[model samples]
Target: MIDIDATLVNVHSEKEGAAPTFKRGYGFHPLTAWIDHGRAGGGQCAAIMLRAGNAGANTAADHQQIIGQALDQVGLGAPRPRSGP
Candidate 1:
């Protein structure tokens, strides 16, 4: 399964996409997707997209785009890692 999440990153200086965050800090917000491997704890990052700190958290378009990017990154068109030793 794929789990998507967003995180706040603090920036010390001005950055191209950095902006004031709700936490009253300046930085970027990045959305990321991870492939879950259950008890194996072998999850891997599927994709990541960066947005300005002020970007809305519940934006549908952002969610959809991130999911699509994650799918494309790990889709059948891409080779999967070897499953066995």
Candidate 2:
């Protein structure tokens, strides 16, 4: 399974790619994708997209791209369909 998440970072000073967030705070909004290992153990990170502070939180395109990145990390190609339920 793939887990996607985003968090707002508070920028303290001048920095590249930094901007004013929706909360009126200055920082960045980074979108990340992770592989879920569930009960097996700790998972791995698949991708990270560093977006500006004012970036859209629920953008469909961003989510789609991130999902594709995670799929690429699989390296085994697309999983085959289950033969039976």
Candidate 3:
């Protein structure tokens, strides 16, 4: 399974794509996907997408793209075929 989330990275210097976040800090918000190994707690990162700090967390387009990249990283293709009856 895969888990996706986003976090704000604090920045001390001016940089492209950096903006004010909800946390009232200047930085970049990056979305990341991780492979859940189950029972193991933490997992390996599958994909990361950098965005401006002001980017919305509930953006459907970004989530879809990130999910697709994560699936690809795990060797899964789009429109995965169903197995078992």
Candidate 4:
């Protein structure tokens, strides 16, 4: 399984993709995906995309791209077929 989320990274200097976040601080918001390993312990990160802090979290296109990249990083090709229960 894959878990994805974005976090705001505080920045002290002007940098590419840095913008004002909801917290009124200038920084970059990076989206990250991590694989779930359960009892085997927390899994490693599969993907990360750095975006301007002003970027919306609910963007569908960005999510799709991130998921595809994450799958690739985990040795799973994008657009894999779903398994039936």
Candidate 5:
């Protein structure tokens, strides 16, 4: 399992002050669980909580992109981005 803080730091370092620019700022944490793989027994699964602001269009889009990149870095691939809540 990967630590959320570490992933965030790696992501932040890649961008130029992009972390703080998040609409309402942001926080993420990943939870790991074991899933049975039938004959193989069990494997790892993750649930990520990515919290961000309800900012304007451009800022929100940018932050979403950043988060997607970060997830990709850790082998998570891109998230299914949602429209506003």
Candidate 6:
């Protein structure tokens, strides 16, 4: 599991006739992913439930790759503390 800071990106609104918002409602998306032996695999999956019409901002393939790269850069590729003390 990787915790993301939702405020860092732009998201759309799902409600009709409503303006797009940011960092409101649920502020996180849980990705149950694993980078194993130089490969990525996992059965758990989910997405951040935005207001409406927000699906295009981050799709499955793009998001997975983004998160995977971030994890690699932050030393998450190896075993370590997942959270702060």
> What's the best-to-worst order under TM-score?
3, 4, 1, 2, 5, 6
Candidate 4, 12-81: lDDT as tens digits: 9999879999889999888988888578777889999999998888877778778888989877874765
Candidate 3 residue lDDT tens string, 1-85: 8888999999999999899999899999999998985786869999999999999898888888888889999788568554346
lDDT of 5 by residue, 1-85 (tens): 3322213322443333333423344433222222333565554433333432222333444445555554565577845768788
Tell me the tens digit of each residue's lDDT in model 1 across 1-85: 8888899999999889899999999999898888875787788898888999998888777877777777787663454353335
Among these predicted structures, which one has the highest TM-score? 3
Better candidate by lDDT, 5 or 6: 6
Stretches of model 3 off by over 4 angstroms after superposition: 79-85
Q: Is candidate 2 or 4 superior in lDDT?
A: 2
Clashes of 2: 0
* Model 5, residue pairs in steric clash: none
**What C-alpha lDDT does candidate 1 achieve relative to the native structure?**
0.83
User: What is candidate 6's lDDT per residue for 1-80, written digit by digit as tens?
Assistant: 55432332333534343343344442223323333323243322223432232233455554655566556655665643
**Candidate 2's residue-wise lDDT over 1-85, tens digit each?**
8888999998899989999999999999999988985887678989998999999999888987788778878874475443324
List the lowest-lDDT window of 10 residues for candidate 5: 1-10
Instruction: Give per-model CA RMSD.
Output: 8.7, 6.3, 5.4, 4.9, 10.5, 11.1
lDDT of candidate 6 at residue 63, scale 0 to 100: 60
Candidate 2: lDDT over CA atoms?
Answer: 0.86
TM-score of each: 0.81, 0.80, 0.85, 0.82, 0.28, 0.27
Look at candidate 1 and tell me the lDDT of residue 36: 78
As a TM-score, model 2 comes out at 0.80
The worst-scoring run of ten residues by lDDT in candidate 6 lies at 44-53
How far out, in Å, is residue 15 in model 2?
1.0
Q: lDDT score, residue 23, model 1? A: 96
